[model samples]
Target chain A: MALREDQILRYSRQILLREVGGRGQQKLLDAPVTVDGASDVLDVAAAYLAASGTPLFDRTTHGGFLAGTSLESFAPDAVAVTPAKGWLGSFATAPTIDVSLFRLAVSNGGLIGVPGGMPWPGELEGQGSSDSVTLGALAALVVQRFVLGLESSLVKVRNVDGRWQRE
Target chain B: MPHAVIDITSQVCPMTWVRVKLKLESLDTGDTLEVLLKGDEPLRNLPRNAADDGHVVKSLDTLGDGTSKLVLEVRHG
Candidate 1:
């Protein structure tokens, strides 16, 4: 797909990335990335992707997510994510990531994947200020990176005794 | 020997180079580009940036009324 002049301006910063050049940007634009789960992580992820030239397919109203005049969808590139109440069910049909910040005290806090019965992700319980935003943003970054064909792994950020753990 | 042309005389500082860089990205290997701008920062920095990115700066010439023209040959490895 030929990039328009405005698109060049809109996505120039990312396009400058060696990992995410015009070709990669085009892939992002063409890709239909769906973050079905409604979490702060997906919220921030949607914003960054849309700002970077990818558009939400749902055209989810601003403030419904972005919450300011800063939300503008120009040159929308067919990328969107909506709040999924039952996100686990969608995994069977779509490529989706299950993301949530959890409390350690919650019993049986298991992460379920598509078709169910997958190895449950561990529960993250921590003390002090829970930085859900940071965790969510990191998850979003991983999702977007993976969608853009960048190297990504099944990394988890768990909170333990007020400290964050990466595995 | 295909070439592309863009005029960024009205654009400001970093954005000028940003536009030029994007324009260059849009070009194919061995393609040439002509950039038109009218600012000291852009004129001073564009050629340096082009060279820094390994593109060949064919020529840099100032025009009457303060506009400048630069020729860049795209070379990607």
Candidate 2:
């Protein structure tokens, strides 16, 4: 379907991007992305995806700080669904590395990340103080890149000092 | 070449370009799009942006109703 006037206005900022014009914006809206992870990661990823007009499905049980919040509250075009049977992309996050889950995400062409600077196979060093927000936003961008047919690679995000670096 | 008409007189800056870009995406190379737009920002930027995107600006005319009409040709890779 062609973009409605409201959609054109709503996504105008991203639509102006050379990598994300009207066609790319429409692809984002048409894509249903599933989320799973720690609450902080889920919070940031869901917010970014919803604001970008990507239909979101919540698979997280942690809830955390965003338990009561609705993804649709983020934007006019934001939509949230439960038990989504199919999706174009998946994002998973956690404070510790889960080898099985990581392999699954990479194999399925999905994005998965651990909070930057967190030690492997262990709990987050400071939990709420970690940079899950930045990691989550990067994961959401990975989904956006995939949707727009941009070149994206599976990489880890690590916080070096105060900077979040992708490796 | 096919011709299409769109009126973006109610839109501003990026949305104006967004609407025109979407229309252009639906056409073939050499297809013409006529856009009726109002406002200085879109008048100044739309044609420049369209041309930068590889579409040709055939003509731009100001109507008596204080609106400008821009003619663009589609280009796709």
Candidate 3:
């Protein structure tokens, strides 16, 4: 199917990128990407992908907090999410995210572990508001570029220290 | 000799170019498309952007109303 008028307007900013011309945009629309994580973590990622016209299937923990979960509300019907609970291996049947988050797992006011240790480091204890915002956006970035068939190494975002760090 | 035609006379900018660009991408190299749009803005921008993307804009003509017709040729990389 052709891109409709509203679709064009909705995605013009992304479409304008040289890497994401008409064909690349269509690739996003065609690819079905499932973000597997807690609702809190996947919130921003879900919104970003959906906003860009990427078909999003959201997977969250069975009892994980959802709805009013994200710091902000994403557009209605923008996300087609399925709340589920199982081993991370369940996501293996589908494309396990090829990207990694090399964020600091702050332990005792310092960093620990190698980059890409886990999507969500347990050391976070209670996720701060800023953590949610940063993680959400980072998840979206990983999913969007993957949809466009672009390759990126471990992405280092602002760490628990609120400082940019890479490994 | 466009392979397809899309009418965006009721739509606005960026969408005009986006719809045209998508239609062009769906075609084979050397295939062409004809777009129907409204107002002078699309008329001014459509052909120019199509050319900038390395596609050919064969012709643009007024429909004697607020509408305009643009002809574009696909040139895929």
- Candidate achieving the largest lDDT: 2
Q: Candidate 1 clashing pairs?
A: A41-A136, A63-A67, A104-A125
Chain A TM-score from candidate 3: 0.60
Superpose all Cα atoms of candidate 3 onto the true structure and report the RMSD in Å to 1 decimal: 7.4
A62: Cα error in model 2, Å = 14
For candidate 3, write residues A1-36 as lDDT tens digits.
555556666678778766797667777776656555
Model 1, residue A146: C-alpha shift (Å):
2.5
Local accuracy by lDDT, each model: 0.57, 0.66, 0.61
* DockQ (model 1, Cα): 0.21
Looking at model 2 chain B, report the run of 10 residues with the lowest lDDT sum.
Answer: B11-20
Instruction: Candidate 1: give the TM-score of chain A.
Output: 0.56
Write model 2 residue lDDT over A1-167, tens digit each, in one string. Answer: 77776777777899888778878988887766656544555666668877888766544543322232645466544553222323322333321212234334434433455443433322333344355554455556667777777765455644456543455
Ranking of all predicted structures according to TM-score, beginning with the best and ending with the worst: 2, 3, 1
List model 1 lDDT by residue over A41-144, tens digit each: 45555566566654333223411223322234421332332223233334345443333332121222322111122222233222231354444444445555
Task: Please tell me which predicted candidate would have the highest DockQ against the true structure.
Answer: 2
Single out the weakest 10-residue window by summed lDDT for candidate 3 chain A: A98-107
Each candidate's DockQ:
0.21, 0.70, 0.51
- Which clashing pairs does model 2 show? none
Q: Which candidate number maximizes TM-score?
A: 2
Which scores greater on DockQ, model 1 or model 2?
2
Candidate order (DockQ): 2, 3, 1
